[model samples]
Target: MFVSTPRTEASILHADLDSFYASVEQRDDSSLRGRPVIVGGGVVLAASYEAKAFGIRTPMNGRDALRLCPQAVVVHPRFSAYSDASKAVFEIFRDTTPLVEGISIDEAFLDVGGLRRIAGPAADIGQRLRERVRDEVGLPITVGIASTKFLAKVASAVAKPDGLLLVPPGGELKFLHPLPVERLCGVGAVTARKLHDHGIRTIGEMADVGETVLVSMLGGGAGRHLHDLSWARDPRPVHVGRRRRSIGSQRALGRRPKSAEDIDAIVVGIVERLGKRLRAAHRVSRTVVLRMRFDDFTRATRSHTLYESTARNDAILGVARRLVAGATPMIGERGLTLIGLSLTNLENDDAVQLALPFDADANGALDVTIDSLRDRFGTAAVTRAVLLGRDQGMVVPMLPD
Candidate 1:
């Protein structure tokens, strides 16, 4: 674990949108102003700040969000529009600095260390970036300026919803010490509860526990990680040209007890779509991961590494089916409510080796042919039988990629 040393020089900047999807909807339709807005049907995909004030959040049930804010307006997702807006905002970042590392569609870490003479100081650059995004893209963005990537991220989180924050040199500890322990990266509910039980509720308290005690309490990796962050220490550089390493999808089925057949069908649909995306990107995945959320909200993940990397839908779906089967006992006891699929261990298309001798290439060839057809036509032109009538439509625009 490494703690970042505060420096007078600010180079890294993190930019993030404020209630991105909801904000976009509000911007497009002025009538939604000051009213709660929910952006999904089955799930409360994204909620406006107004809805959030009413205790609504993402991954929540749409029905519950409506109950919280009965006057809230619901809207379906607009992916193409969001993607266009993202491209426009990213263009602004690129214009300012060449070393912009995108974390998601709406957030990125910009390294402007080499732009002092040309683009002014980091603080000024951040201000300009925010204004540009608002004026050109019609969305509000918050920015955090710091000397390191971790501090920049923390700074951005602190200054959200159309705000800007700068952590000056030698002020890192002062800014971090009083924050809740749960605010630290990787300190989820489980870790926060554990820390609170030990009377370590704040970052400063965690720091006082010392590295040795944290290691003993939280185990080597997690303990060391918390200890380092407690001191406002992070050394990750803002690197450019970072490519996505995985493609995945998840669906929340609320508290409903879906049957094994239903779960299998959903998992198959997710894997099929994900495999198509992998092939579109000219990549192959050697690992498949299955994530499940039970009706009681307890979550578990199972993963399997394939004998070789491949982008075929059948191969990926086969592994996913096996993972779902293995989790059947747990599902029987708790009842499954949500399912997810992710393909990892990715490699470039050129890196994939052909299948071994005696294996039929028909399936692979058919997958490629299907992909080409979909590329020429639309995504709707090709759909799995399970997904044919499942036109719930996109509930909310995901963070643009």
Candidate 2:
């Protein structure tokens, strides 16, 4: 006689801080308690739950946010304070489990599979983790427990604003099916529109439509991706110390109109910073992408793949400028509000063929020299003429490289 073994229990916990930046502000200032707070003047960086109740959201124009919540208190971002709070919260996460995988400064996926023998059930562990974050860090955090990372992330999203939810081991589909199709990963605005047009309003509905039809509608990769997730088939583990695949930075250009020169300068500043970061991480990129957000809240992206991977700032900037110039027509029609840059298709520097004397990156020597100076002195020790006398923009905190 043959017997079937029991499946693994739900042990993945996705913990995400509740309105991280806004919560930090409320925690530090008693007077701000229960008040609608928006933490940015130009673009809404973060909005407290109180503010969110009034339809305020991040990346929305601050003026529009104020129009929505007339009583909302506007405050400039304190990136340093948010960073400190994130560090403190991460410390708490590390103390909870050695199997913590940080997704970002404000969120992480923790695997507590074997810890149940000592720490009790995954649900209990998640509850305790939330309590610890609340009591120690003085920040509200939501935790989702499930057998898979995808389900855990979805559960956390559903249980937002300091809440916890668990999808029992055999009940993944029951918990997932009723949710809207937009809940699935990779189902963005465009994909969601397509799914909705097909009358696939829920995860269960999408699943019933079957993979073949989905593939035709959403293309091969994305169609297959959603089909797998609808039935809770994600196999990604909580990766610890994961290296980032891409390094990117963006500047929020306020409602004010920007000239082509102004946009180019911002692109240069962003690329300069990203280049230094890429080299510092000992990584090279083969693709450069330029992202633009319009006043109408729509976004467009253009990318160019290089003949070879390189981390030289000038080389990356050249590609970025070309991408931006190509998008110039769209920017003119829509009116640009934000511009960002990303270097992707990354590989370890060790994989790069050593440059010969004749084929070396012309700026490679200068790039390394400037990086060294910045490391010994400060980042401000080196400067580019285009970036000079311009706001470099705030350095948003990120997970470990």
Candidate 3:
């Protein structure tokens, strides 16, 4: 059974770029090699491996990161350059498999189940992928081959920077068991603390606790999800053509206490950007999700579903303002460390049968015209009143589609 399982597990491969954005920066700039590089201003967008060694991480405040790695060389992120590199790497991925599901700009799941005859084997494909990414794209990537998405992702994480790891099917338990519970997706700080209180410290310990107990402990949705992942039995397919349901952005404000007006301004900026993206995509969002992270790293998200889907900034910002108000009482003196805005429940405009009875076509047309101007001239050409001065001259971080 064990020998048969090893053969079955080699079909799924997860490819993850090493320290993607920072790596690109290091590769493009010869002077940045072997030194700590931190990208982004006001906050740490992404840090190089050297900076990471000093405990600097993404989404951290720039000041904190600088404090952590005093010798870190800070560089502004070049999204255009990163995008070009990503496109090249993805093109290589397509050459290897017809079924590649991108999880982010830096990582993807490739299903080479039917490529045995041509590609040789999963290990061969992984090696070729690493070589192509290195030789052609000028970047280092890590590849992990396993039977399931969960294990594949875990394997890739284990083989970071530039490496390859393969987990055989029957070896899932052995591969996963000793890992910290935090290694399991969705088990963030809060979840980890909750599980720790229950004496669950590792994936193996979580598995030993039984599914029924976990469900009772963490609620039906998260409990069942984590329990299954603890056993490395994910059944998700490597799907392609998966359109994103949400477009969102977040800014970290550090540990300082921000005034309500300050936070509102940030939210407005996010909503404005989100609205532009929606209009450009010709899609409307039916739901708005507001995520807030506090100084102590505790986070909360509140969402509201609109009666009608629209890409109008007025509509989205209006709801976002209300959601912020609702969350203000929770803010307290600790202040907000991070603010995020996301639009979800998305559908194409063609699917929108008609505009709302209360909405005027004039407003929709105006939005389309504005989007066209911004798209051509750039996002800063046209801006809302709330976003003015709040622009901070910092470019938003781009996420992988």
Candidate 4:
């Protein structure tokens, strides 16, 4: 008789770059190494471990961050440099395993199952990955290994700033139950405070309260979600080459009031950038969304859906302009501090029917020509008249298609 045995050793690995922007700064300049570094002039985009030791954090106002650490070195962001470094690190990740799922530009989940015969244990593979990244890409990365994706992600967060950890099989609960409820997935500020108020402070305590009780306290969906996470019941696989659901970009404008023309130019620049990215990824979207943030820290969104999907800038821009016009009344009421644009309901270009030659849009050819020129010369080779002398904002980094 032939018998089959299930394999259950921990094989999922989560790899994350530590303080990505700040690490890049320390790597490139020797003077910045071992010193507190801050990466942005207006908002604190990233802070080095040295700076974090002084109670500094990201997204804090640069002025207030200086108050925390007066000697911290603040540098203007160089998007080009950070983009290049991210590409280099991802190349190393793909070299390690074929099953790499990128969560963002700075982190990914890798499945290394069924490779023990060729590559030894999963822990050995993770250690080698860390070594290669440090030697080749010149950056520090932390890695966590566990049986499930959720546990692996939590383990990585626990072991950060250049460290590695692995949770062995048959010991998942002993390791998980001791952690705070905040360490579990789907437990944000509101959920954590609610759990604390109910005298459930730890994952073990939450588990003891029973699912029926939890469901009564929190809503049905959230209560069920937290209960399952308390037991580490995740079954998600590490997917490779997954396409992004939507693509978008945004810019922060100062508090100083400006005319409507200024806002219009910013919208044009954002639309052009997003359209380029959409076409480059070979995807088209049917819905265009406009997101705004006011000086009072309140936010609002407006969207318009088109009859057909398209990747042309003019087509997307037409929809975006109408959305902005519709929200102009709200913008006038609240002072605008930030504005963003997003494309959703995405699909592959080949999924749509092609237009006949006689009915083809001229903008399609123009898009191709501009993309080629930017590829050969530079992104600045061609630009709209309105954006010629304007600060078009930085191009945010994203995962590869």
lDDT of 4 by residue, 305-344 (tens): 8988899989988888898899888889898999999999
The total number of steric clashes, by the backbone 3 Å criterion, in model 4 comes to 0
TM-score of 3: 0.90
TM-score, one value per model: 0.93, 0.91, 0.90, 0.90
lDDT of 1 by residue, 16-126 (tens): 988888888898889998889988787876788898999999878788888988988999877677777778888999898877777888888888877889878889999
Query: What's the ranking of the predictions by TM-score, best on top?
Result: 1, 2, 3, 4
Candidate 3 lDDT, 106-218, residue by residue in tens:
78888887888987878888999999999999999999898887788889999887999988768889989999999999998889999999888999999999899999989
For candidate 1, give the lDDT of residue 56: 95
Pairs of residues clashing in candidate 4:
none
| Position 216, candidate 4: lDDT | 95
The most accurate candidate by lDDT is: 2
Q: Name the TM-score of candidate 1.
A: 0.93
Alpha-carbon deviation at 123 in model 4, angstroms? 1.2
Q: Write the per-residue lDDT of candidate 2 for residues 1-401, one digit (tens) a residue.
A: 11112236898889999989999999999999999999988778899999999999988888999999999998778888988999998898888888788888999988888787899999999999999888988999999988888999999999998999999989999999999998998998889999889899999999999999999998999889999998899877777777888888988887688999899999988888899898888899999988889999899889999998998988899999999889989999999988999889999899888655565655388899999999999988988887789887888878756
Better of 1 and 2 by TM-score: 1
Query: Candidate 2 — what's its lDDT?
Result: 0.88
Where model 2 places Cα greater than 4 Å from the true spot, the runs are: 1-7, 254-256, 295-298, 359-363, 375-377
> Candidate 4 at 158: error in angstroms?
0.5
Query: How accurate locally is residue 21 in candidate 1, as Cα lDDT from 0 to 100?
Result: 80
